[model samples]
Target: MLGYQVPSPDEAMLIAGGKNKGSTPFRVVTGHGAFVLPFFRKARFLTLSMMESEVDERCVTRQGIALNVRAVIAFKVGTDEASIVAAGQRFLSDQDQMSVLTGRIFAGHLRSIIGSMTVEEIVTERQKLATEVLDGSKEEMARIGLGVDALQIQSIDDGDLGYIAAMSAPHTAAIQQAAQISQSQARQAAAEAEQESQRAQAEYARQTAIVQAQYKAEVDQAQASAGQAGPLAAAKAQREVLAMQTELAQRNAELRQQQLVAEVVKPAEADAEKTRVLAKADAERMRIQAEAAASHNRVALDRMLIDQLPLIVREAAAGLNGANVNILNGASGLSEMAASLVGQGLTIFDSIRGNLNGSSAEDAGEPDAPEPERPQLGDGAHPRPD
Candidate 1:
């Protein structure tokens, strides 16, 4: 088991000291089982995997400036029978030395590439420098049974000379100035925008105040009109009331005029008719008296007395009708009462007729008697003229 080896995928197993090994000089084993019978077999491992190396070298650039360049190179043993055999023959004893040898080889090529380019070109165009180094070292690496995968220039420094920094100063200052200007412009624009916003707010506030004032003025005017409306309406109603009162007064005056016309005119008309009738009666009486002066005076008196008889009876009956006579004994008391009333009425009539006859005889005897001798007649009695 100690002499029996199984190689890994990244390794090649080389064997010597067997009948097939020394006679064949060497045999490669890869990714399979291999038995080395212990004493008769000797085996060594050679790596075929990828490897990387770093090279730091101080080289003179085309500008005669010394620059220290650090670079990394990726390389591997070629996947071919010839390359694997060649690598195995050389590095089978010390597999770790492959990276060491690769570093030295690329160091020389990196120095050569940097020496051909300027310091500016070496610092700015690192890929070009790496490409040149890779191309220059390609043939030398292949002869050593290696293949280059990638080459990168990690850093380039100009030792004590600040040539690279000096070259970038103007551009760096210009960039700083541009950044400062952009920041200043942004601040100025923000200030201007803030000023504009404040101005707009002030304008809006002023306009709002103006509008409020106008609105308040309108409200005050409307309130004043509203305050005046009650009195104005009341005054208008008062005018209407006054007009109605005036109409009532006019109506009352018309009614009063009509009442006065009825009271004064109707009574005056009745008095005028009565006066006319009285005047007519006086004329008829005077005519009768004049005619009676030619006839007998006693006969005229007798005629007048006969005409007054009915009026006297009616007055007596009217007086009796107004009298209140209570009868305790029904029909007999009433009959007695009626007889007494009839007797009194007859006696009154006879006394009136006697007075009238006596006055008529005296008037006939004294036809030229004085007015003081005439007497006034009582109710229901006719006048006796002298």
Candidate 2:
């Protein structure tokens, strides 16, 4: 353990006083342990870790503008044996000098690269400038047993010249205008969003109000219907009752009219007809009775006239007897006077019978009978006794 040595993961062990293998002054042992006699061999350690170097230099651009350029380089010692041997031989005594030497080397390259480019290229194309610087210094850094991982240009400016600022003026102005436009657009979009939110809220409120109004209207209508329900029902019932009463009254009136026709009008008509029939029969009977009476009276009157005819004849003859009695042909004259007296008596009898019969016929409402013919006597005819 005393004569054996091990190197750290980020370091290389260099044996300087041993028998070396290649055309190098040290034995580079990496990633393992080795045996070293303490008095016979001299060993040292070289770091293989990552290193950072800063380069800040003033350089002239292709446009004759002097610019201060600052840059950073990330480098490390190489992993191979030749690279280890080279790094150990150079930096074995002082390992911190690696970063210094790397910084100086990159500074020279940075100045040379920046001189070939314009200030615009140096400002805008910083990656290109770094890449070219890295590429130009690649072989030289490798000879010094260093490998570059990356190169970054930190800043580039013209000191008191304002050339970079003057050159970037248009782009800066364009960028500011673009920024202002973006801000205005953002504000406009925010305002539009706020208006849309307000509109949505208003619409929601309006819809809610409409729904509430409809609900209230429906409720009011329902309540009003409920309120009118009893009155409407009562009105309907009253109408039905009135209609029934009216129908009953009409039926009663019709029944009364029928009863009057049966009890009063029909009986009256029957009584009137019976009375008329009785009156008619009495008138017929009275007419027949009068006709019979008139016939009887006429017969009696005829009999009485017959009885008085002889007397009338006698009287006439007597009257004649008392009158002037001169007879013209003696027996014939007497006979003629007696015949005239009988004829006159007969005429008188007929007249009396006709008058009585006419009176009787008039009383009986019958037509008068015809009078009989009177007896006629000749002037000189004798009266017959028969």
Candidate 3:
């Protein structure tokens, strides 16, 4: 850069090289190996227009104890050094004049960083301030033949303690939550274990109680049985004794029954036998008397026959030999037959009379009147008593 004052856009100046004897729109001055110049448009293009040209640029803060402003802006016109020199030389030949223009163009960026508080922020973040200033300066100066590609804010010295602390808060909360989760899991596990332990204790207590109750019940049962053992044994023994006595009594009664059968029953059976024989003999005697009475009944039939004899004889004479048997012949025939029947009838009457007085005879012991002898029935002697 050359030390010179920037001129207005309408300013015209002479070229440093003596090759041109007249003034141009931009003035140029020669530097050590390059030329500095000013133009209406950037990149040394001196088109008579008021527009700023496009290019790439960068800026850097000066490294001393001053404002944290951009003190330098590196311009990169698209063309190479020869093109840059040619573009500058076409309108401006004085390099000092071109430097003045370039300085004035970039000066506004330095002014933007001039506030005392701007330095306060710049002091906190100089690199960021420089990066912004460089960008603005490059654009401001592009109208004066300078351009740039990109600008970057390098490392900043701003303090991040609060941000760092804020960033750690979530991690701290997460760690606390993890600890809480771990503690909850442990507590839950412990609770489960306690519940299991309680269940085990309850089970053990229940089993122990059951065993004790069973033992107590068994002991009570055994005691009750022991208390009843003597009385039950004695009662059973008494029942057995009673049964033996009853059996002996039954056996004695059976013996007595057999003896009675032999003595009283045997005699009674003999007497019944004698009574049956006597009753049979009496029945036979009564049957004989009834037959005798029936025979006496034939007396009336004989009388009827006697009266019917003539007709009987006539019937007989017609049927048999005309001659008949002799009546009243010999000792007995029909006449004797009839007479014997009458006499037998009378004897039955006398027998009945004797029967009527039968039991009185033994009471009085009187002699019974004898029956008159019936006339002999065609016999010389009456029939003897049957």
TM-score of each: 0.52, 0.52, 0.27
Q: Candidate 3 at residue 158, lDDT?
A: 18
lDDT of each: 0.77, 0.87, 0.53
Better of 2 and 3 by TM-score: 2
Error at 260, model 3, angstroms: 6.0
Residue 3 lDDT (model 2): 88
- Please give the lDDT score at residue 231 for candidate 1: 97
lDDT, candidate 2, residue 185? 96
Model 3 lDDT-worst window of ten: 48-57
The clash tally of candidate 3 reads: 15
lDDT by residue for model 1 (1-386), tens: 76678988998887877555333367878889798878777888889888999888889988899888888889999877667777887787887788999999999888777778887787788888878888899899888788999987787878768887777787778888888898899899899999999999999999999999999999999999989998998999999999999999999999999998899988999999999999999999986885577356546655776676667656766765645545566676665555554545556655655566566646556343222222222222221222
| Candidate no. 2 TM-score | 0.52
| Model 2 backbone overlap count | 0
Candidate 2 residue-wise lDDT, 285-360, digit = tens: 9978877777787788889899999999888777655455555667877776667778799888878887887877
